[model samples]
Target: MTRDRQYSFRKVTLDDLPLLAAWQSAPHVRQWWESAEPYSAADLADPKAARWIVSTAGRPFAFMQDYTVHGWEDHHFAGLPKGSRGIDQYIGDPEMTGRGHGPAFISARMNALFEAGAPVIATDPHPENALAIAVYKKLGFEPAGPPEMTQWGLILPMLARR
Candidate 1:
């Protein structure tokens, strides 16, 4: 299927560090991310993580990462399909919030992950993030279980299958 023309994804690069740091520090992003440190080369070099900058008409606005569930021990998806992958994303540009980009770009990326051999995909959003839960449901992701505590905090587990 053709990706929606509204957005694109490109592997994040060192050149994007400053931009990414600025975005990470934005009030909207920081609220959920709960991080104050700027991103570093080491963070970007995580071998198990596929990181990308989500853009719209060539303007960057979001960050996304996908990793194999097995790569993270004790992760929520450990018992699912062997090739299961998990996704984490945030729209760094506050102005872009409330737009349709969340579901559009996520759906596009999820398709790519499936094509790359992921039989299942999961995402754990903060349990109170109603907007994110709604978008995931709209994209056909169903609740896998109740909210669970994780190193990051409490998340509502959700899953999608190919």
Candidate 2:
């Protein structure tokens, strides 16, 4: 999808910890993310995940990450092909919520992965997250299957093939 606002991503670093913690704690974010605990250095150090701080014109506003689904411990994405990448993200700024930035940022990230030769990319949002599901569908993601309860939450699997 085309976006009037141009956005980019930067590799998430230690310097972003405070902002990450704050965003994770925001009521708007926590409502769905449900994480009250702060992100430890170890979380960002995860080898299977590539984390990024999404920005527009060099100003940070969101957090996003993509990880090899198969590399995750007992991931629900076993049905997906090997080399499949899964994404998770949140708009850190409350003011940015409801804007089209989510889809734009996701599109940019997915395009990067496709350019890098990834076979496919996927995302799992809570089944009840209609807003997220809608945005993902608008970006060409289709439901892979019904919702399943996992340690993270009840998720509706979706995939976008390159």
Candidate 3:
């Protein structure tokens, strides 16, 4: 699908719960996202956490999440600078996988963040998620350090783009 025809991103709202839950439950999407808990409407209700729905002509296609890293001590990025932010995303529709949407969507989001004064962003995917790792790398994210158990940290430098 052409870029204009295939995707759009909008701030997620409470009305998007059902669509988000369904996407989170898809087998292909769950493979890389298998965690014990499921997301709830309350989770997406937090104003401090930014979430977006990736859609095509108003239909949900994926989910993207971002949050400030201040005071975070999470395993994925325990060593990052205090002001850094975390970004995570998933393409919910199985058909959209392997079609290059990941890179485009992420790049779009990163550009927006940088424009909003974000200095750096980070993401950590399972080391075995080669497709995701490659897509992040192709968008100019570099391996931040040696792989840690389960999570591989990657960083994108915003100033480098200036």
Score each candidate by Cα lDDT: 0.86, 0.87, 0.70
Top candidate when judged by lDDT against the true structure: 2
Candidate 1 colliding pairs, count: 0
What TM-score does candidate 3 reach? 0.79
Q: What ranges in model 1 sit over 4 Å off?
A: 1-4
lDDT of 3 by residue, 1-162 (tens): 255654677878777777777887889888777642545677667654688898766767788988776634454554555445678899988887887777877877887877887767777776778888878777777777665564333332221131
lDDT (Cα, 0-100) at 5 in candidate 3: 50
Q: What's model 2's lDDT at 97? A: 79
Candidate 1 local lDDT, residue 46: 81
Question: Which scores better on lDDT, 2 or 3?
Answer: 2
What is the C-alpha lDDT profile of model 2 across 27-131, one tens digit per residue? Answer: 889878877665668977888889999999777999999999888568898567778899999999998877778888899899998888778898999998999
Which pairs of residues collide in model 2? none
Cα lDDT of model 1 by residue, 1-162, tens digit: 235566788888888888778988898888677666655788778877888999988889999989888877887778888888999898988898887788889998999999999999999988888888999999989999999998778899999999
Clashing pairs in 3: none
Candidate 1 lDDT for residue 150? 85
**Model 2: CA > 4 A from native:** 1-4
Q: Of 2 and 3, which scores higher on TM-score?
A: 2
Cand. 3 Cα-lDDT:
0.70
TM-score of each: 0.91, 0.92, 0.79
